[model samples]
Structures are given as C-alpha cells and as structure tokens.
Target: MRRLRNDLPYTFRPARPKDWFRPPALWLNRHWLLERKYRVTAIEEQGFERVRELDATGDSMLLAPNHADHADPHLMMEIGRRYELPFHFMAAREVFEVSKRASWALQSMGVFSVDRDGPDVSAIKMALSILAAGKPLVLYPEGEIYHHHERLDPLHEGVASIGMKACGRVSEGRQVWLVPVGMRFLHDPSVEATFRDRLTRLEDRIGWTPKPKMDLDERILRLGQGVLGLKESEFQVNVAAGGIQDRLESLCGQLLEMVEARMGSDGAAGTAPERVRAMRYRIRRRLLDVDHPPGEDERTLLLDDLDRVFAALQAHSYIGDYLLAEPTLDRRAETIMKLEEDLLGFPLYPSARTARILAGEPISISEMLQRGELPRKGGASALTSLLEERLSRLIEVPAGAACSTELVSRQSGETG
Candidate 1:
C-alpha cells in the first residue's frame, strides 16, 4: 500500500493500481450499482462508435464530461464497458476515504485521487503518465456536480491544461485528442407527486405552514422568502423590499461584501459569480498555503470566514427559482429535485429516468496548436468555450426550456 508522506499535501500519493482489474465484475456492478441506486432506466449512447474508431488509431484521448449529477462517473463506467475501452478517472480524495473497500475497488477501476482544494503535482503526474501510455483519461472539468440539468456551467481550464501539456510531450507523429462528452439525465415524470409529498414533509419539519391555495411557484417563492429572511437576520442585514430575485441578489451581495471587506478586497467589478470565485480562490490559497501556516487564532478566523463565504455562495444558487419559469415536465422535475436537494443537502436521483451520453466530434490538440489557436494568455478560456459549445450542441432541450440564472461557481461549474 502507498502511504502519504509528511512532505506531501494531506492524503496525497502517487496513483497506484490495485491488486487486480476485474472487467466482468465492473461491468456487472455498473448494471446493478447505478440502476439500483440512482434508478437510471437506460443509458443511450450516441456516436460511441466514433470513440472506438479513434481508439483504434492508437492516439491518446481525454474524456471531458459535464458533471450534472453524482451518478455521472458510474454512467461513464457503463459507457466504458459498452465501448470496450478502459479509462482512468480522477476522483476527489474524499471518495476514497469513504471506505477501504471502496478505495480498493476504485483503484482497480483506474481511479486516482485528486486534491481539488489545492495544487497536487502527484495527481497531475499520474494523469500525464496515463495519457503518455496512450490510455484514455476521464477528467470532469466542472470539478463538482451542480445537479442543475439543462444548464451548462462554465468549464475549468484544468482539463485543457493537462491534456495539452501531455500532448506537448508526445513523440513525433502521435496525436492527443480531447473528446467532449455530455451526459443528460432526463427527469422522471412521477417526480411531481413525489415532489409535493417531500415539500409537504419539509414544511412540516420546519414548522412552517403554507397557504392552502398556493401553487407550486408560489410555494417555492414562499420557501425562498422564509429562507432568505432567516439568512438576512443572521447576517444582521435589513430586509430589502423587492421582487424575489431582486431581494435575493441584494442580500447575497451584502453577504459577499462582508466577506470581501474582511479579506481586504473591494470587488468593484465582475459579476457575482466572478467575485465569489475570486474570494474562494483567495481563501483557499490562504488556508492551504504551506509556506506560511496561520496561527491558532488566525486559523480560526480564516475558517469562519470561509464558512460564511460558502454559505453565501450556496444561497446564490437558489435565487429566482429558475426551474419554475418554463413549467415543462422537465423543468418541473428538475426544480423539484433541486428543492429536495436544497432541503435535504444531497441528491434525490429520481427514478425511471433515461440518461443520454453524447460524444461530440473530438477536438484535436495538435491541429489547434498548429493553427496557433492556443495562446499563453486566455488559451484555457478559449479551449473551455470550444468544449462547452460542442457539448451544449449535443444536448437537446425544448424550445422554451429555461433553468436557473445562478452564476456558475468557477470552482464547481460543469460544462454541458
């Protein structure tokens, strides 16, 4: 067993393969694990043969999939089996800590641990080695699962950076390609009944009574108002009189400004998402900076500041009930799921839903480099846009479908 050293980041270690690789076990487990747990009815694959064709050419490929649900990685596992391709996935370190058995199984399935809160060279080196060996690497650029289906969040540059950097080290004629994979989990129709029941239970649990005549949107608005009122009281900010969206925006702005002031930042420009992201980056850097560790009081203060910032960020996602605007079956189900998750602090994984995995035409790193499309400045942003565009095109939503307008958190945003 590999051990984390004192010199390394907490839980950091070189990626290690398990004692065995059991393809049949993994394939069987995928069928039972995802279906039984998440109730995924069927996984429809589009253009999967193209990926097989690319693999046949012996060129390295990277799988960059948008993460909207926790079941995404499991879906990818099943896809790997169907395509007859084994790929390595970079999972957050917390997953491995769930249990020794889970860690072993994950490692055997070509999963490596990533410390996303800070830079970890060990994980990057492992990724490069996987690409150099002509193996496919599955890296979700979104970093975290957003649970907001139909909406594509902003992409992180890490996926492009790792793939491009590895491609640069390839021998003369070989090429590396980044495949944009989009996974869309359609909501189960029965979610409406379940949603009403769950929301009723939540209201009861909180000892809050709703009007008998309230509609779905009205109830959502009421819940939002109650939650926002509590937060405003906690923060000692005066309740601003406005529409739900306006009030939410104002309150969140105030909360964030509090953190920024404490951190010595003005945040004069940029959208709320951008400001929250910068604050998080600064907080994480300070918290994880090994060169100069904070003293006891300083550490306590920093932790408290981070807690407040995260709370404010969480509040930002619930603004305006983006799911209620369209009121389509899909939107209703998504909104219901989001509300349940917000109340329950986890995913519901609604039942009998079809998941579509569409692989877009692979983006060629060599071709992009040759065309001078990549720049030292903003290269990752350009690449992120290209991948997001490709994946977004693959997702088909109804003409009037709309989702929450919450700004995608930079640290946790997922591409389409």
Candidate 2:
C-alpha cells in the first residue's frame, strides 16, 4: 500500500550487486532492521532445498514470490543469508527515489530499479544477464504490495517472458527454473487489541463515533466504506449504488476511464493496474520529453492525470470481499493496515510477526519448451498461469467457518 509519486522522471538504476557488501548488510538487516523496524521477529524458510539443488546443478533460477507486504524483500534477504546465496532483486524505481543513501544501499545489495508504469529495458536486461550467468534472481510477479497475505493479485506475464527469453540465452545443457516463493506473515494473537485500536482511530478520523459494541468484521466494513466514500468525493465520483466490492470496481473503472480520456487514448483493455500503467507510460513519455515539453497548463493537467492513475490503483486494491468471506485475524489486520495507509498517509507497525517463507516446486522453462507446453503464440500467458497456480497452492488457505449470511448482508448494505 505504498503511495508512489509518478511526477518524477525515471532513470534506470542497474544492480551493482557487491558480493562483499550483501552478507554483512543482510546480517544487519536480519538482526536489526527487520526485528526492530519491520517487526518481523522470525523467518522460517521451507523448500529452499530446491533452491540449493538448482544451485548445485549450475542451473539458472528465477524466484517469483507473491508480494504481500513491504517487508518481503528484507525477508528474501534473510533467506539468502540463511542459504548463503547471492540474490538479485528487481524493485520499483520509486523505492530508489527515497534517498541517495537508500538507493546506493539497495543497488549494492543487488537490487535494480524498474519503472512499473512503463517497460524498463534496463531491468529486463539485468534480469536476463543474472539468469544467463547461472545466478538466482528474485522477481515478484504480483508487482505491487496489496497487503493481502492469504490471496494473490494477478501475476504479470512479464516475469514469464523474462524467464523464457533468458532460457534462450543460457548455454546448452543448462536450464532456467522458475520458483514460486510464497510468503505468509503470522501476527501474534495479542496484536488483536492493537488492530482494534487502529480501527477506532480510523473511525475517529472519519468523524464517526467509535463503535465498540459492533462486531469487528462490521466495524472494518463500515470503516472501509467510509474511506471509499471519502475517496469517491475527493475524485468527484458518484457514490455508486452497490456493495463495497461493486462500488470499488465502479469507482476504479471510472477513474481509469477519466485518465484514458484525458490522455486522448482509447481505453486499454486489461486489469485496472494494467490500464493504469499504460496510461501513465503515455503521460510520462510526454511529460519527460524535454525537447517538446508540455505547456504549463498542460503539465498541470498531466500531473492531475497521474494522481487519478494512482487513485485508481488504490481503489482497485480494495475491490474484494477479502474480509467478508473469511475474517481470519490475518485478513482483518491486513485490511486495517491498508486503511491506515490510505487514511493517515502512513501505516503503523502493529506487532512482532513471523514470516513463513515457502519455496514451491520450480517449473523448468527448458522442459516446458521441449515438451511443447509453451507454444509460441501464448507461451508467456501459459507460463504465467502455471506460476500463479503454483504460488496460490503454496499459500492456499484452509476452508473455515465464514461470517453468517445475515452478517454478510448487513455488512454489504448500501454505502452511498
């Protein structure tokens, strides 16, 4: 739920990947930063034997993990430290813009910047080189952190494309493997009180009297609706008449359509995130064109369009019945964390948590191509689906008791 500013021009930041720096940096992060700041007290890694096995065979590896939290990259560093592997990461360019020191530290840690709003050729080339050199590369196919630990957003096919293309570059007799790494965070049960306090604060911020007597699920839903309504008003959107999910989808769609219209482009056909990316790419290309810079008024409009693009993405993240379907403590906490970020402009670290890092079976790109499973026409999509399915299985939630129908109905009442 990080709010990225799109007004800045992108400069591709390649990976320096200092072998000497990574070990100590990771140790410091694991011992200090993660435990003290991120509240990730423990990290348990599973199935990394597969990673070790692949490393043993001199095979190239592309580790695709489901991105659920901002703490994921640090957790990956912990894994690399535990297994003694050099891991290269493809991170968003916005992260590098935080500060010069942070950017330098990230690059030294083997992290490169990628402009998610556009095609970053530098990042693709770096990834290709990492894989071709028989090294392990980590890329999150989910791309953005939605803070939904139990479920995954759609997997971007670009990861599969990079893996397949890297396969073509590898020396004969060697293979490139795609490993789906699942990350799940388990918060301490005592943190429920902290979550409740967060909900109360959100209610107070929205000018509503705290509802201590209300069930936790209902309070969360009401808070979400309140936040959504505020966003709709801010964007001058009509409060769509429907349940939370429906209203969210409607608002997101309208926002994207607005951006597309302003950019003088036809609507892009894809997920909300995809369309937003396409529009942002077009707008940024124009904005960054120094030789033919946009006029002051036009620049103002373009910046406004960028704001709408981000708003659309934020709305899209909340467009689901994540809590209503099964209100696990993790789900409830994640929902509130997202709300905190959106409302207060920053999220508070709730409590100490354990991150379970499970590496699922690796899918061999070479074997799939040889087996004709990856046809030329839709090979990327096919591979993406397979990767998505694997990651989903690794983090699959057990069927459990859900909220009663009456409660769900009450929670879904019209928010407009």
Candidate 3:
C-alpha cells in the first residue's frame, strides 16, 4: 500500500489531455516502465471488442477496474492505445503532489486529481463532463491500491453514481455504458525464492531468528499476529485474543472510535475506509483553514489523529482469510510483499509477472434506467452491487482460461 500523506491541502486538478503526448507517453510506459519497474512481462486482454463496439456507436463509457496494483493505470493506458481510444483517468490528489513533473505528465496523459477525503464536487463534475462528451472515463471503484490481487476491496459507490448521472447528461442517441474491468497479476515461479529471502529479512528486522524449518504459511501468519499485537499495544488497547480476522476488525474499530472520540464527531456508519474519510475530513477542515488555523498544540494533536486514521485504514486493507482461503503462490508472495512494505517502509521489487486484463460485458446505464431496472432511489448502490459481482467473477477467471478472445458470460459460464 502506498503511504498516505496529509501535508498538502486538497485541490482539484482537471484533465488536460494532449493528444500529441499520449501515444509516446504510453509507449514509454508499456515498453520500459511496466517491464523494468513494475516487472510486468506480458499483458493479455479479453473483451476489448466491447469497448470498441461502444466507441463505434459514439456512446459514453466509464471503465471501472479493480485497483489491485499501482500499475493499473498504465496497464489501462496500454489497452486504450491498442484499441485506438483515448481515456480520462481519475486519480488521488496525493499522486499529483508527488512532483511537478509527475503532475504534468499525468495531466498530459488525461489524468485528473481527486480529493478522496471530502466531497470533491469538482472531480465529480469533471467526470460527468468527460462522459457527457462521449469519451472513455476510467475510474477505479476500489479507490486504493491495496495490493491484494486475488481479492477486491469494497468499492466506493461514487463510480456508480457518476455513471448513472452521466447517462442523463449525454445526447439523446448516445448511451452511457459502465464497463467492469478485472485485472489480475500472475507472478513468475522464480519469485518464490525472493519471497523466502524477504521472509528471513523481515524476521531479522522484527528481532526474531529466521524460522527456516517452519511452514511458510505458518510463518506469515505468526508475523502478521505479532505485527497486529504491536499495533494494539501502541494504541494502548488490550491485545484481543481470537482469530486474525476478528482481531483485525476489533483493532480497526477501536482505532476509528478513538479518532472519533478525539474529534467529538460521530463518524459516518460504513466501512472502515468510509469512517476514516469522515474523520480525516473533519480534522483537515480545521488544519487547512488559513483564517482560523489550528494552534500549534491543536495542530499537533490533529496530525496525530490523521496518522491514526491512516493506520486504521491500512489495517482494514489486510483481510486475514485471504491467504488461508486459497494459499496460492501469488497470495503468499503478496502477503510477504505487503509485510515488507508496512514494516520495512518500502515495497520489495516484484519478480517478472504477467497481467491478465479482462473486460466484462458493458452494463448499459441508460437502458437500465429507461427500463426501470434500476430505481432512482437506490440506483447507485444497486448498480455498484452489480458491477462488483461482475468484477469479482472476472478476476476469478482461471489463469489458463483468461487469455481466450471469446466473450464468456459471467452468469452462464459458457463460451461462444
């Protein structure tokens, strides 16, 4: 997981796509950066024709992909290049603040910044405009890159809301489509050795002797428990005794409640991410107010609250049963990688991998609304559930079976 930073004020950055720069930028990303930096050796795409057919009709499209890795945007850009389509991307504001050159490059490639902590009306309007203009807009429903490739985080409802609202804004004959894209990464078998080495390094850092004789899965679970215990102690909460999943939930709740108590605000009832966003928004509103800036002591306290909010969200990202359910090699490696990133403060360099890009059949927003299939009262939530179900099935496509060009209905499990 990328570290969260709260030093910068929230600002909206709109997309300024330069057609001249996108092709070469995409070329460099595909030819060099993805292969060399992200270790992606191959990319296999399925259901791209769905996007092409939608584009042919001049219909507006919103590409909703699971964001399991940081390389997802570049991967999507490569896909757009292949289909001869240009895309507009909605990204977190912190990314644009990384550097001026990065912000410039991202904007040139049609990426815009969004503040996840607050009501970012500007970002929503930008998305509506992009879709209204009959262009492909890419939004990650799973807002954060949690690095859990096999499982998707709870999706934000904003994507569904944007798609539904865009439908009403498009021209008469132009429909709006929500395309659920599933992205999965397969690590090369050679990376198993690297994970073993990483495990040893992590043990050393934690002041424990390397458990070479222990089962790999057991070692990872033990490390995770220890880390969880340390966090509990740090927060002055009694170490909960139970299964990892239960303990994780308990700790996350305690942390969020702690922040809420400090802020004297009842947090919004939802997932941990939602509660964190609420707390952060309240805290930052005071922190960022220039006219009535927080006093030095108040500022210090608010910053601490922000840190705890980040920690709670991070803990929530690690679903304990992920590895136990499947125990695939990829899951084990991802677990180790996440540990190294959290404990060691930097992610391990991933080994060579192949990315499977699966685009599901498009969900026509206008058609659903027109047919009264989607009720306006809770349409966003309903549409979100549908998209989530489709994306979950798409990501579950077996490695050997995902490369086929045939359109496989996620519902029927049949091939044409």
Full-model lDDT for every candidate: 0.70, 0.83, 0.85
Per-residue lDDT of candidate 2, residues 371-394 (tens digit): 998985679999999999999988
Span of ten consecutive residues with least summed lDDT in model 2: 400-409
Once fitted onto the true fold, the runs of candidate 3 whose alpha carbons sit more than 4 angstroms away are 265-268, 404-416
* Preferred candidate (TM-score higher): 1 or 2: 2
lDDT for 244 in candidate 3 is 89
Better by lDDT, candidate 2 or 1: 2
Ranking by TM-score: 3, 2, 1
lDDT of 1: 0.70
TM-score of 1: 0.83
lDDT of 1 by residue, 318-410 (tens): 536565566666666665565566566665665677677788889888778778888745677788889888878766643323322211223
Each model's Cα RMSD:
7.8, 8.4, 4.8
User: Could you estimate the TM-score for every candidate?
Assistant: 0.83, 0.92, 0.94
* Candidate 2 wrongly placed segments (more than 4 Å): 265-268, 397-416
Candidate 2 residue pairs in clash (backbone atoms < 3 Å):
none
Best by TM-score: 3
- Scored against the true structure, residue 29 in model 1 reaches a CA lDDT of 60
Candidate numbers sorted by lDDT from highest down: 3, 2, 1
Worst 10 residues of 3 by lDDT: 407-416
